[model samples]
Target: MAGCDVKNNPTYLLVVAGAISDGAGRWLMHRRPLAKAHGGLWEFPGGKVEVFEKPTEALVRELYEELDIEIDPAAVEPVSFAQHDAVDDEPGIVILLYRVGEFAGTPRAVEGEGIGWFTVAEIDGLERPPLDVELAAKLGRLFPE
Candidate 1:
C-alpha cells in the first residue's frame, strides 16, 4: 500500500524486486513468514516503491530492511518485469526485477521465515507466489545457456 491512492481505492502499485546472484549459478530468495501473505513460499527480496523514492532507491532500502545488505544503485541492472492488472478491489502491481551481483554484507532473513540460495532449476521447483513464478521464468531467460 505504499503507493496506493489517498482514497484507498484500487490503484496501481510499483514494486521492486532483486535477484541477488552469487555469480555461481545461484540466487538468493527469501521465504515468507508463516503469518504473511504467500506464507512459506519463496520470493525475491523487495518491497513497494514509496511515493518519493526511485525504484532503485526503494530496492536499496528494502534490501537493507529485509536482507541486511547494502546495494549500490549503480550496480543493479534491470533484467525483467512482471505486472498484473487491477481486479475487483485488489490493486494492480508491477514488479521490476533487477539483477544484483554485487553488494555489501551477507544476506540474512531479517523479516522472513528463512533465506536460501538456489539455481534457476532449483528455484523453479520451490513453492513461489504467482508473480514470483513469472519472475523466475523471466530470470531464467536472462541466462540462456
Candidate 2:
C-alpha cells in the first residue's frame, strides 16, 4: 500500500437518474441550482445512491425529493448510463439513468432551478454536465426521430 497516492486513486461515485416522460415524446430534465456542482446545467433528474440502496430505489427517492413527484419503483426501467472521469479534486461519477412512464403528482423543481420537458432533439442542444451530455446522446439513439 506504500506509495499509493490516495488522490490519484479515483473514487468512483454511483448516481441514479430518471428519464421521466409525460406520456408524450418529451422527457423531463432538471436545471441544477446555482450553488451546486454543474450548477445551472440541465440534467436527468437524479441523485447519489446511498449505502445499501439500490439504484432504482435511489431514483425513486431523488425524484420525490427534487421534483415533488412520487414514482413506482416497479415501473422503472433502465434506459442508459454515463460516466464522468475524475477531474482535479472531484471524484469520478457513474450515473445510471432509468425511465419512468407513470408517476403521481405534477413535477415541479423543488431543489433545482427549474424543470422542463423536451424532445431528444431539443435536449441535445441544451447545456448539460459532461455525463449528461453522454446520456442525452444515448437518449437520441434510443428514441430517434
Candidate 3:
C-alpha cells in the first residue's frame, strides 16, 4: 500500500542520551518502563530532542525529568552516536550519546523507571537496548578492563 511506504514518507527522530559516571568509574543506567518502547530494557538516561531545542538542551531537560538531576549543558561531552533504521512500522531514529562530566544533585528515578549504577565490568551483563549496547561498547574502549 502506498500509505505504508515508509521509504517515501520517512520520519526521523533525534534522541539524546547521557552516560553519567561517578568519579570512581560507575555509570548510571535507566530501565525503560514496562509500558514504554523497549520496555523493561536498560538504557542511558535521556529522551527525544524536541523541535526548536538543541540536543544538549533536550538532554539537560530530560535528565531533570527522568532522574531529578540538574546538569549543565557545558558539562555534556559528545561521546558517540547511533543511526538505526526503521523497524516494523516505526520511524528511524538517530541517537546521540553524551558523557555527563558534571551535574548537581543525586540521580533518582523520578519517572517510575528502575535505576542503577554499573561499572564497566558489570555492563556486559545488563540487558541493554540496541542503541545502548553500541554506546557501551564505545565506552568500554575508553576505560578498558
Better lDDT candidate (2, 3):
2
Candidate 1 lDDT over 1-74, as tens digits, reads 57757555636789999999998999999998899889999999999998889999999999999999999999
lDDT of 2 by residue, 1-145 (tens): 7876755564778899998888778999999999998899999999999878998889989999999999999999999988877878788899998989999999999998999999999998899998889988898898775
User: Clashing pairs in model 2?
Assistant: none
TM-score of 3: 0.89
Off by over 4 Å in 1: 1-10
Please list the C-alpha lDDT of all candidates, in the order they appear: 0.92, 0.90, 0.88
| Shift in Å, residue 74, candidate 3 | 1.1
Give the range of the ten consecutive residues with the poorest summed lDDT in model 2.
3-12
Per-model TM against the reference: 0.91, 0.90, 0.89
lDDT per residue, candidate 3, 22-127, as tens digits?
Answer: 8788988899988987988889999999878999999999999999999999878898898789878688899999999789998998885689989977987999
Clashes within 3 Å, all models in order: 0, 0, 0
lDDT for predicted candidate 3 compared with the true structure: 0.88
For lDDT, candidate 1 versus 2, the one ahead is 1
